[model samples]
Target: SQQGEEDPQALSIQEGENATMNCSYKTSINNLQWYRQNSGRGLVHLILIRSNEREKHSGRLRVTLDTSKKSSSLLITASRAADTASYFCATPGTGGFKTIFGAGTRLFVKA
Candidate 1:
């Protein structure tokens, strides 16, 4: 089964600062993905890091995966008010057909 849990259910940061979110899983995973969801909107894929990869970057977003520890972290640089959203981590379940999502971390950026 796919099981991922994100820590710090809520976070508040100021604009121009950095925001960090973490995820921990119970079982081995081939890959992990991070997503952001705006209020009343869809979840936007932020980054994906494979089991063999330690760190990946996209734009201002950085993701690190540690298979040994079964954990991952996402860092958003230069936070903005518009970046306020709920962030989630996902991993494929058994058979690689199901995607399980974490409880998500609600982030609020103050301008």
Candidate 2:
């Protein structure tokens, strides 16, 4: 499967702490994207790293890609209670418009 799966389906942390998640896939992909969704809100794009890229960072979030192993990781530093939400990893489909989302890692950041 070209789709990837994330470890630790759930996570809980105190405000100001860091959270890390890992993902693994079975096949090659064009790029991988991280998204955040709050409760009922729509998924918000966090970052997108192409296959050739090794690492990327944005604000308090850091993402790393290892195409040789077909895996990736996302790390969020200094998390806030407002950061409490479900995070997902997606890989664009062959058709481009389609992307496959994993079950997601629900993160709860307590104040």
TM-score of each: 0.97, 0.94
Candidate 2 residue spans exceeding 4 A from truth: none
Per-residue CA lDDT of candidate 1, range 17-69, in tens? 99999999998889999999999999999888999999999999999999999
- Per-residue CA lDDT of model 2 for 5-98, tens digit only, reads 8877999999999999888877789899999999989999999999999999999999999999988999999999999999999987677788
Q: Whole-model lDDT, candidate 1?
A: 0.95
Which residue pairs show collisions in model 2? none
Q: Which stretches of candidate 1 lie over 4 Å from their true place?
A: none
How far in Å is the alpha carbon of 49 misplaced in model 2? 0.3
